[model samples]
Target: MILSSPDPAADPHVAAALLRLQRTSYAREAVLVGDERISPLLEDEIGLTAWRGRWLMAWDGVQLVGAIAWWETDDAVEIHRVMVSTSAMRRGIASTLLSRVLASASGRPVAAATGRANQPAVALYAKHGFRAESDEQIPPGIWITRFRHAA
Candidate 1:
């Protein structure tokens, strides 16, 4: 399936879908993050405006199954979010989104981070050629693992 850019202006549905994706996906990470931050992180505005970076959404004939977004820094593209509908997990949605993003970032380094306990995300990054660069305690209680995709 082909990935498409989100049209926040034309589609109101994306706002809700992105909100739900954020809520559910981050719930798993809330153990590493407090409810205070996780709650706001699920807010729709953040996901709706995610297109300010590189956003890619996968559609299965009008139904949005997955989405991702990333920001390009001076030296690397930092993936900010990657989400697939619960029913769409393990079906290559994230992989397809990442592949599309990586293609756009061709010849440059790509990077991503996830909660240290989020093994699936770590595995996904590894599957796409990203190697773990650091695991650090960025906050009082949270451990974040940073990964970089070498060119």
Candidate 2:
């Protein structure tokens, strides 16, 4: 496995690949949360490039296996997305990507959110020293659990 900081904004092919990865990954997340309207599932490559967040990608010899995207605020690092292709599951891709993010946070708080029903994601955050701070309801019944890694 290799990790890279691909420029999705500057590279059309990278953006397309990232979009494909995001859709496949988030599609599973939508099923896990039982919500077809999850925002990530609806995002397009154009919308993706607009956010301008920092990204760390994990590759399996030319395959875009996983990626984590985040934004840096004045006092914290807000993780927007952590995605792993369904075919690449159980191989530690998400963990490796997240570990890299936490290591580069430089003591600033790192925040992330996942569907509250997504136990695997919650466990991953906990394994990396993140604590569940709260649960939010969006569009009424769907629950999202927010986490924070504070050093």
Candidate 3:
């Protein structure tokens, strides 16, 4: 597997593929969380391109398998999204992408949020030294857990 930052504007095809993957990946999370209104599932290619962040993508040869997106603040990096294609789950793709994200943090803190009921995601973050700090309700009923990696 290869990891790289891809410019969506430079390749429309890749942008579309990533959008499709995001939708599919987030759809499963929606089910896990008992909500179909997650924001990632509603994003279009145009909106995705407009997001202000860096995307780290994992590829197996020419196939896109996983990706993580984040934006840096003065003291912390906020992970906006982490996804692996449905067919690519259980393959360490998400972990690899997240490892790259944490390594790029340069000692700054890193934080992310996932559905509170999404055990796989919660476990993944915990395994990487992130501690759950709180839980929040976004769409009124949907619960999300916030996690922060130790600095």
Candidate 4:
């Protein structure tokens, strides 16, 4: 797999593909979390293009398979999204994307959140040295686990 930063302005197709992948990937998360209104699934391509994060896309010989988006702050990097195509799950793609993002963070803390019921995501973050710091409730019943990587 090849990883590259995609410029949405130069390639609108990347944003469209990312939106499709986000919906497809997050649908499973929605089921796991018992919430059909997870942010990724509710987002549209227009909103995706307007997002203020940089994306690292994973490609398997020209096919978009996964992506990780993040924004850098003064002292922390906030990971907005980490998505792998449903067909590409369990292939180490997400881990690879996360590794790249962490490397690019240049020692700043990294923060991310996942649905509380999304065990795979929680485990993935743990594997990368992130610790569960807190939990948040959105829409009343849905719980999200916030994680932070300080290394």
Off by over 4 Å in 3: none
- RMSD of every prediction: 2.8, 0.9, 0.9, 1.0
Tens-digit lDDT track for model 3 on 2-100?
Answer: 988987767898898899889988988999999998889888889999886999999888888899999997788999999999999999999999998
Q: How well does each candidate superpose onto the true structure, as a TM-score?
A: 0.83, 0.96, 0.96, 0.96
lDDT of 1 by residue, 35-61 (tens): 335432645665465557766888888
Compose the digit string of candidate 4's lDDT tens values, residues 1-151. 8889977656788877888889999999999998898889888877888887788999998788999999998788999999999999999999999999999888899999999999999999999999999999976899999999996
Which residue runs does candidate 2 get wrong by more than 4 Å? none
lDDT agreement with native, every candidate: 0.76, 0.91, 0.91, 0.91
lDDT computed for candidate 4: 0.91
Task: Name the TM-score of candidate 2.
Answer: 0.96
Clashing pairs in 2: none
Model 4 quality (TM-score): 0.96
lDDT of 2 at 106: 90
Q: Which of 1 and 3 is ahead in TM-score?
A: 3
* True-structure lDDT of candidate 1: 0.76
Clashes within 3 Å, all models in order:
0, 0, 0, 0
